[model samples]
Target: MASSTVNRWLRPEVYPLFAAVGVAVGICGFQLVRNICTNPEVRVTKENRAAGVLDNFDEGEKYSQHFVRRFVRNKSPEIMPSINSFFSDPKL
Candidate 1:
Protein backbone atom coordinates (compact mmCIF):
# COMPACT_ATOMS: atom_id res chain seq x y z
CA MET A 1 0.00 0.00 0.00
CA ALA A 2 2.76 2.42 0.98
CA SER A 3 4.81 1.53 -2.11
CA SER A 4 1.80 2.12 -4.35
CA THR A 5 1.19 5.51 -2.79
CA VAL A 6 4.87 6.42 -3.23
CA ASN A 7 4.77 5.37 -6.87
CA ARG A 8 1.70 7.51 -7.46
CA TRP A 9 3.44 10.59 -6.04
CA LEU A 10 6.63 9.88 -8.02
CA ARG A 11 4.98 10.63 -11.35
CA PRO A 12 6.60 13.23 -13.65
CA GLU A 13 3.61 15.54 -13.27
CA VAL A 14 4.36 15.78 -9.54
CA TYR A 15 8.09 16.38 -9.99
CA PRO A 16 7.82 20.16 -10.34
CA LEU A 17 5.70 20.43 -7.21
CA PHE A 18 8.23 18.32 -5.32
CA ALA A 19 11.10 20.42 -6.62
CA ALA A 20 9.35 23.65 -5.59
CA VAL A 21 8.59 22.29 -2.14
CA GLY A 22 12.16 21.05 -1.76
CA VAL A 23 13.61 24.42 -2.71
CA ALA A 24 11.29 26.24 -0.32
CA VAL A 25 12.19 23.89 2.51
CA GLY A 26 15.90 24.24 1.76
CA ILE A 27 15.73 28.05 1.75
CA CYS A 28 13.73 28.12 4.99
CA GLY A 29 16.20 25.74 6.63
CA PHE A 30 19.16 27.82 5.54
CA GLN A 31 17.64 31.03 6.84
CA LEU A 32 16.67 29.40 10.13
CA VAL A 33 20.22 28.10 10.65
CA ARG A 34 21.83 31.36 9.57
CA ASN A 35 19.71 33.38 11.97
CA ILE A 36 20.32 31.00 14.84
CA CYS A 37 24.07 31.03 14.26
CA THR A 38 24.53 34.71 13.43
CA ASN A 39 21.78 36.80 14.99
CA PRO A 40 23.21 38.27 18.17
CA GLU A 41 19.92 38.55 20.03
CA VAL A 42 19.08 34.87 19.52
CA ARG A 43 22.57 33.36 19.72
CA VAL A 44 23.97 32.87 23.21
CA THR A 45 27.15 31.11 24.17
CA LYS A 46 29.09 30.70 27.41
CA GLU A 47 31.76 33.09 26.14
CA ASN A 48 29.17 35.74 25.31
CA ARG A 49 27.25 35.29 28.56
CA ALA A 50 30.34 35.17 30.77
CA ALA A 51 31.79 38.21 29.04
CA GLY A 52 28.59 40.16 29.84
CA VAL A 53 28.36 41.29 26.24
CA LEU A 54 24.95 41.30 24.64
CA ASP A 55 26.48 41.70 21.23
CA ASN A 56 29.83 40.38 20.03
CA PHE A 57 30.98 43.25 17.88
CA ASP A 58 34.14 41.66 16.49
CA GLU A 59 32.50 38.34 15.77
CA GLY A 60 29.57 40.03 14.11
CA GLU A 61 31.89 42.06 11.94
CA LYS A 62 33.87 38.98 11.00
CA TYR A 63 30.73 37.00 10.17
CA SER A 64 29.39 39.83 8.05
CA GLN A 65 32.31 39.38 5.68
CA HIS A 66 31.86 35.62 5.35
CA PHE A 67 31.49 34.40 1.73
CA VAL A 68 27.90 33.19 2.11
CA ARG A 69 26.87 36.35 3.92
CA ARG A 70 28.51 38.51 1.27
CA PHE A 71 26.85 36.60 -1.53
CA VAL A 72 23.40 36.78 0.06
CA ARG A 73 23.86 40.43 0.94
CA ASN A 74 24.81 41.38 -2.62
CA LYS A 75 22.29 39.20 -4.40
CA SER A 76 19.42 40.94 -6.15
CA PRO A 77 16.08 40.93 -4.38
CA GLU A 78 14.23 39.60 -7.45
CA ILE A 79 13.64 35.84 -7.55
CA MET A 80 13.23 35.68 -11.35
CA PRO A 81 15.10 38.67 -12.70
CA SER A 82 15.09 37.62 -16.35
CA ILE A 83 11.34 37.04 -16.45
CA ASN A 84 10.73 40.24 -14.54
CA SER A 85 12.87 42.25 -16.93
CA PHE A 86 11.27 40.69 -19.98
CA PHE A 87 7.77 41.53 -18.82
CA SER A 88 8.67 45.03 -17.62
CA ASP A 89 10.56 46.07 -20.73
CA PRO A 90 8.90 49.12 -22.30
CA LYS A 91 9.74 47.84 -25.77
CA LEU A 92 7.84 44.56 -25.23
Candidate 2:
Protein backbone atom coordinates (compact mmCIF):
# COMPACT_ATOMS: atom_id res chain seq x y z
CA MET A 1 0.00 0.00 0.00
CA ALA A 2 2.78 2.43 0.85
CA SER A 3 4.63 1.48 -2.31
CA SER A 4 1.46 1.98 -4.36
CA THR A 5 0.91 5.46 -2.90
CA VAL A 6 4.52 6.40 -3.62
CA ASN A 7 4.18 5.13 -7.14
CA ARG A 8 1.09 7.25 -7.71
CA TRP A 9 2.91 10.37 -6.59
CA LEU A 10 5.96 9.37 -8.63
CA ARG A 11 3.86 9.32 -11.77
CA PRO A 12 1.28 12.07 -12.39
CA GLU A 13 1.18 14.20 -9.24
CA VAL A 14 4.95 14.70 -9.44
CA TYR A 15 4.56 16.59 -12.71
CA PRO A 16 3.36 19.82 -11.12
CA LEU A 17 6.51 19.97 -9.02
CA PHE A 18 8.57 19.28 -12.13
CA ALA A 19 6.74 22.05 -14.01
CA ALA A 20 7.28 24.49 -11.17
CA VAL A 21 10.97 23.61 -11.12
CA GLY A 22 11.23 24.16 -14.88
CA VAL A 23 9.57 27.57 -14.55
CA ALA A 24 11.90 28.51 -11.73
CA VAL A 25 14.96 27.49 -13.80
CA GLY A 26 13.70 29.50 -16.74
CA ILE A 27 13.21 32.57 -14.59
CA CYS A 28 16.71 32.20 -13.15
CA GLY A 29 18.19 31.97 -16.65
CA PHE A 30 16.37 35.12 -17.70
CA GLN A 31 17.59 36.97 -14.60
CA LEU A 32 21.17 35.94 -15.33
CA VAL A 33 20.94 37.28 -18.88
CA ARG A 34 19.36 40.47 -17.59
CA ASN A 35 22.20 40.93 -15.09
CA ILE A 36 24.83 40.40 -17.79
CA CYS A 37 23.12 42.87 -20.06
CA THR A 38 22.71 45.56 -17.43
CA ASN A 39 26.15 45.47 -15.78
CA PRO A 40 28.95 46.41 -18.16
CA GLU A 41 31.71 45.42 -15.73
CA VAL A 42 30.21 42.02 -15.11
CA ARG A 43 29.73 41.48 -18.82
CA VAL A 44 33.33 42.44 -19.47
CA THR A 45 34.59 40.13 -16.74
CA LYS A 46 32.60 37.28 -18.20
CA GLU A 47 34.02 37.95 -21.66
CA ASN A 48 37.56 38.05 -20.30
CA ARG A 49 37.05 34.80 -18.46
CA ALA A 50 35.66 33.17 -21.59
CA ALA A 51 38.61 34.36 -23.62
CA GLY A 52 41.05 32.91 -21.00
CA VAL A 53 42.67 36.27 -20.25
CA LEU A 54 41.19 36.23 -16.76
CA ASP A 55 42.70 32.84 -16.03
CA ASN A 56 43.46 33.39 -12.37
CA PHE A 57 40.31 34.69 -10.74
CA ASP A 58 42.20 35.18 -7.44
CA GLU A 59 45.32 36.87 -8.81
CA GLY A 60 44.81 40.48 -7.89
CA GLU A 61 43.01 43.29 -6.16
CA LYS A 62 39.88 41.97 -7.81
CA TYR A 63 36.93 41.54 -5.49
CA SER A 64 33.43 40.24 -5.77
CA GLN A 65 30.86 42.64 -7.03
CA HIS A 66 28.49 44.02 -4.48
CA PHE A 67 25.83 45.18 -6.85
CA VAL A 68 23.66 46.63 -4.12
CA ARG A 69 26.51 48.71 -2.73
CA ARG A 70 27.58 49.95 -6.13
CA PHE A 71 24.00 50.53 -7.22
CA VAL A 72 23.21 52.50 -4.11
CA ARG A 73 26.36 54.61 -4.41
CA ASN A 74 25.70 55.33 -8.08
CA LYS A 75 21.91 55.54 -8.01
CA SER A 76 21.55 59.32 -8.00
CA PRO A 77 23.76 59.89 -11.01
CA GLU A 78 22.25 56.90 -12.77
CA ILE A 79 18.67 57.90 -12.17
CA MET A 80 18.78 61.68 -12.65
CA PRO A 81 19.29 61.77 -16.38
CA SER A 82 16.58 59.19 -17.08
CA ILE A 83 14.21 60.84 -14.67
CA ASN A 84 14.78 64.28 -16.19
CA SER A 85 14.25 62.98 -19.71
CA PHE A 86 11.19 61.03 -18.64
CA PHE A 87 9.51 64.16 -17.33
CA SER A 88 10.70 66.46 -20.07
CA ASP A 89 9.78 64.36 -23.09
CA PRO A 90 6.30 64.53 -24.61
CA LYS A 91 4.58 61.41 -25.86
CA LEU A 92 3.86 60.99 -29.54
Candidate 3:
Protein backbone atom coordinates (compact mmCIF):
# COMPACT_ATOMS: atom_id res chain seq x y z
CA MET A 1 0.00 0.00 0.00
CA ALA A 2 2.81 2.42 0.91
CA SER A 3 4.70 1.49 -2.28
CA SER A 4 1.65 2.29 -4.40
CA THR A 5 1.23 5.62 -2.68
CA VAL A 6 4.85 6.48 -3.23
CA ASN A 7 4.60 5.51 -6.90
CA ARG A 8 1.59 7.75 -7.33
CA TRP A 9 3.46 10.67 -5.78
CA LEU A 10 6.50 10.06 -8.04
CA ARG A 11 4.53 10.42 -11.28
CA PRO A 12 5.74 12.98 -13.87
CA GLU A 13 2.57 15.06 -13.64
CA VAL A 14 3.37 15.77 -9.97
CA TYR A 15 6.89 17.07 -10.69
CA PRO A 16 5.84 20.65 -11.40
CA LEU A 17 3.79 20.79 -8.20
CA PHE A 18 6.78 19.50 -6.24
CA ALA A 19 9.12 21.99 -7.89
CA ALA A 20 6.76 24.90 -7.20
CA VAL A 21 6.32 23.87 -3.56
CA GLY A 22 10.08 23.44 -3.12
CA VAL A 23 10.83 26.85 -4.60
CA ALA A 24 8.20 28.54 -2.42
CA VAL A 25 9.52 26.82 0.72
CA GLY A 26 13.13 27.64 -0.18
CA ILE A 27 12.34 31.34 -0.73
CA CYS A 28 10.38 31.55 2.53
CA GLY A 29 13.24 29.86 4.44
CA PHE A 30 15.87 32.12 2.86
CA GLN A 31 13.90 35.26 3.69
CA LEU A 32 13.28 34.08 7.27
CA VAL A 33 16.99 33.44 7.80
CA ARG A 34 17.97 36.72 6.18
CA ASN A 35 15.53 38.67 8.39
CA ILE A 36 16.77 36.88 11.52
CA CYS A 37 20.38 37.67 10.63
CA THR A 38 19.93 41.26 9.45
CA ASN A 39 16.80 42.84 11.00
CA PRO A 40 17.73 45.28 13.80
CA GLU A 41 14.67 44.33 15.89
CA VAL A 42 15.96 40.75 16.29
CA ARG A 43 18.49 41.34 19.07
CA VAL A 44 20.17 38.14 20.33
CA THR A 45 22.85 39.27 22.77
CA LYS A 46 22.39 40.97 26.14
CA GLU A 47 24.27 44.03 24.88
CA ASN A 48 22.11 44.20 21.82
CA ARG A 49 18.98 43.84 23.91
CA ALA A 50 20.10 46.77 26.01
CA ALA A 51 20.74 49.02 23.01
CA GLY A 52 19.31 52.57 23.22
CA VAL A 53 17.24 54.53 20.70
CA LEU A 54 20.37 56.02 19.13
CA ASP A 55 21.86 52.52 18.78
CA ASN A 56 18.63 51.34 17.20
CA PHE A 57 18.84 54.19 14.69
CA ASP A 58 22.43 53.26 13.88
CA GLU A 59 21.52 49.60 13.48
CA GLY A 60 18.62 50.57 11.22
CA GLU A 61 20.96 52.68 9.10
CA LYS A 62 23.33 49.73 8.77
CA TYR A 63 20.43 47.42 7.96
CA SER A 64 19.37 49.76 5.14
CA GLN A 65 22.84 49.25 3.61
CA HIS A 66 22.09 45.57 2.89
CA PHE A 67 23.16 44.78 -0.69
CA VAL A 68 19.71 43.70 -1.90
CA ARG A 69 18.21 47.03 -0.84
CA ARG A 70 21.01 48.96 -2.55
CA PHE A 71 20.62 46.99 -5.77
CA VAL A 72 16.82 47.41 -5.82
CA ARG A 73 17.06 51.07 -4.90
CA ASN A 74 19.23 51.75 -7.95
CA LYS A 75 16.99 49.81 -10.35
CA SER A 76 14.52 51.47 -12.76
CA PRO A 77 10.90 51.32 -11.58
CA GLU A 78 9.85 49.56 -14.80
CA ILE A 79 9.97 45.79 -14.25
CA MET A 80 9.32 44.58 -17.84
CA PRO A 81 11.01 47.03 -20.17
CA SER A 82 10.81 44.88 -23.29
CA ILE A 83 7.09 44.17 -22.99
CA ASN A 84 6.46 47.81 -22.15
CA SER A 85 8.48 49.06 -25.12
CA PHE A 86 6.79 46.57 -27.46
CA PHE A 87 3.35 47.76 -26.38
CA SER A 88 4.27 51.44 -26.25
CA ASP A 89 5.81 51.66 -29.75
CA PRO A 90 3.74 54.03 -31.92
CA LYS A 91 4.44 51.93 -34.99
CA LEU A 92 2.73 48.92 -33.48
Lowest summed lDDT window (length 10), candidate 3: 48-57
For model 2, residues 54-87, the per-residue Cα lDDT tens digits are: 4455532233445555657656654488889798
CA lDDT of each prediction against the hidden true structure: 0.81, 0.66, 0.85
Better of 1 and 3 by lDDT: 3
Ranking by TM-score: 3, 1, 2
TM-score of each candidate structure, all chains considered together = 0.54, 0.35, 0.74
lDDT of 2: 0.66
| lDDT (C-alpha) at residue 42 in model 2 | 58
After superposition, the stretches of candidate 3 with alpha carbons farther than 4 Å from their true spots are 50-54
Clashing pairs in 2: none
Winner on TM-score (2 vs 3): 3
Candidate 1 lDDT over 1-92, as tens digits, reads 99999999989999999999999999999988988888665636766657654556877787668887677896889999999988998893
For model 3, how does the per-residue alpha-carbon lDDT over 4-23 read when each residue is reduced to its tens digit?
99998999999999999999
Error of 2 at 55 (Å): 28
Candidate 1 residue 62 Cα shift, in angstroms, is 8.2
